[model samples]
Target: MTRRPSPPQSTLPSDPILALRANELLARGRQLESQGKIADAARVSAELVNVAPDLAEAHQFMGSMAMRTGAADIAAMSFERALQLKPRSADLHIALAQALLALQRPADAARILDKGRTLHPNDAGIFRELGQAQLDLGQPDAALKSFSRATKLVPNDLYSRHMASALATTGAPNPGYVAELFDSYAGTFDAHLTGKLEYRVPQALAAALAEHGPVAGPTLDVGCGTGLVATTLPETLRPIDGIDISEKMIAKAQERGVYRHLRTGDAHAVLADEPDFAGPYGLIVAADVFIYIGDIGDLFASLAARLAPGGILAFSIEFNEAQGIAIRSSGRFSHSPAYIHGLAAANDLSILAEVSHPIRLEREIPIPGRLFLLRRG
Candidate 1:
């Protein structure tokens, strides 16, 4: 009895025409979005949702459109409906959690992501999202575990590795880690740093520079995140040039219309090798730049080479009281006063002025730091 294995079963909807219609609408909406007709794509998504209220894909499409349009509330509702229709779908769970996170409900997002992880134990994205949710909830230990798991799953993911490193409270973050961090953060950086963290490094550094009389030639802004230093400096220090690791951050800095030139690169390598950035410049400012940079010995040597005679090199550091660098749990590295003084002397740079101040706030607590103005002999 060669019982032909019963004909392969179909998973298509009972109403094939309706399923076809829904798929066609989804494609059209995606096409519209791809063509940059965002409003039209949104309207198509809305129509799809109405035509196929029971279709999980239709609701997901609507939710994605809402999210793209910054309608997090609408996105949340649509994703919830999608999740209801596809309870076991890992993508649906992630979508709902993202919507919840955007709504500032990290606890809720964490709950959803935890459930998603339970169901799909091997999903790296779920672990990554869960880590972010846990971090938002101030669960660093839990976030560390999640990020570690994600790193284990996707081994080469820089963001996961960096988050793990930050949580482990050790190791100098790699350049890739710093670039990825600021690129993703560039959008909200200015507001968050200035408003929430009460960052005043640029202002303080500018004040210090003003004391040195007038700076001559073009000034260089190192690790110039969003051109804050360029904007804060006096007009006398015009024709400013800036370099940063993150392209997105560089774009933001460019939008400020302050710098004569802006470059996206590791300041260490750029200053050492790039001819355009190489300058026997009058002033080089690195406001709050040393946090991401663990070792400045090489950087100091580079700065010494670039500085014109009597050129000023001004910078700030998260002040570590210990006699060496400390990798803080915040993923930032702090340097001791002794270390900076030693480095400056070794690099033939004389300390002009040193000011200890509260650079910014972390968790509403002021973080102590030091600003140093060094002069090339």
Candidate 2:
């Protein structure tokens, strides 16, 4: 008689009690991760790993926990270990690739996934992550191919949509799409953005203001998000005003009681309508605002008309090349230093100082930003 086939190795419970404890711990770990308690999740997952050393799920959780804590090396180690236990798990391979990508080892990530694709040929998630790895490696063409496959596999994927849009606009003109994306997410702006991103636009603007002389008159806080910058201003700066395109944001700013006047309006148009704005504002501040406005010519002209002679204008801009301003598929605009200088000179403003820093984002990714201080000539 033929011998009965051995039971699947992965089906073993090791011990019923141990399996029950591992399950309980894993559930708690997931809940903690959902609550953004990454440290706690890691701790729980570590316990689960001890109880169920061969469990791929436990190792995957540990990898995710490590990544949340900025422990990329540890995350990579955890993912690699998990892959060894579940060599056929496509999700684990993708997770491993992400960890490798974070460690700036795109070539290694690509190699890992190249093997994974052969083992699990139809996995869309793997292709999507492969695209990201290629993008990180400065191989946009390869990225496009992988992203294309991902979109075909899962048409409604937002991440894939964003990636595709980004690739399409790599060398294209400002198509006015990024603003729409921001406007759509304007409602949940502060809830998802604030501390998670370590956002400190107000602090940066305040520092820029301090470097210049005191604000002798009223001030304008342009694109004032939740009045963060407004509340940070010194009490000596009387009649601080704020303007933004989102009424919901202005309403939130109003709750802070920082601005003497808070209006919901377009920044470019607001200055033009107030033809007599000269004496009211000795300073105009735009923190993390210009990224949405592609053409600074009209905005600068409007600002120049509104400023008192020798009045200072302070703002932050995301940098791009001097030769061109490309609107990314995300619809956000990036400007070059040369473009900024041109706008300042045309508007009769002299650049006093410029400082570059990593701007905080809600997802913990930092983007490059420049703070500029200009005096009306």
Shift of residue 142 alpha carbon in model 1, Å: 1.2
- Candidate 2 lDDT, tens digit per residue, 1-377? 99986532332257999999989999999999999888999999899888888887888899999988888888899999888878788988998998887777889999999888899777889888888778667677888788778778888665565566656654332333333445576677776566567667668778778877766557888888677777777876657788887766777888887777776677777666754343447788888777766566776777766677778888887776554454432335567888889888888899988888666652246777788888886
**Model 2 TM-score (2 dp):** 0.74
lDDT of each: 0.84, 0.75
Model 2: pairs clashing at backbone N, Cα or C within 3 Å? 177-331, 178-330, 178-331, 178-332
Those runs of model 1 whose alpha carbons end farther than 4 Å from true positions after fitting are: 1-20, 179-217, 224-235, 238-242, 246-265, 269-282, 286-377
**Best-performing candidate as measured by TM-score:** 2
How does residue 83 of candidate 1 score in lDDT? Answer: 84
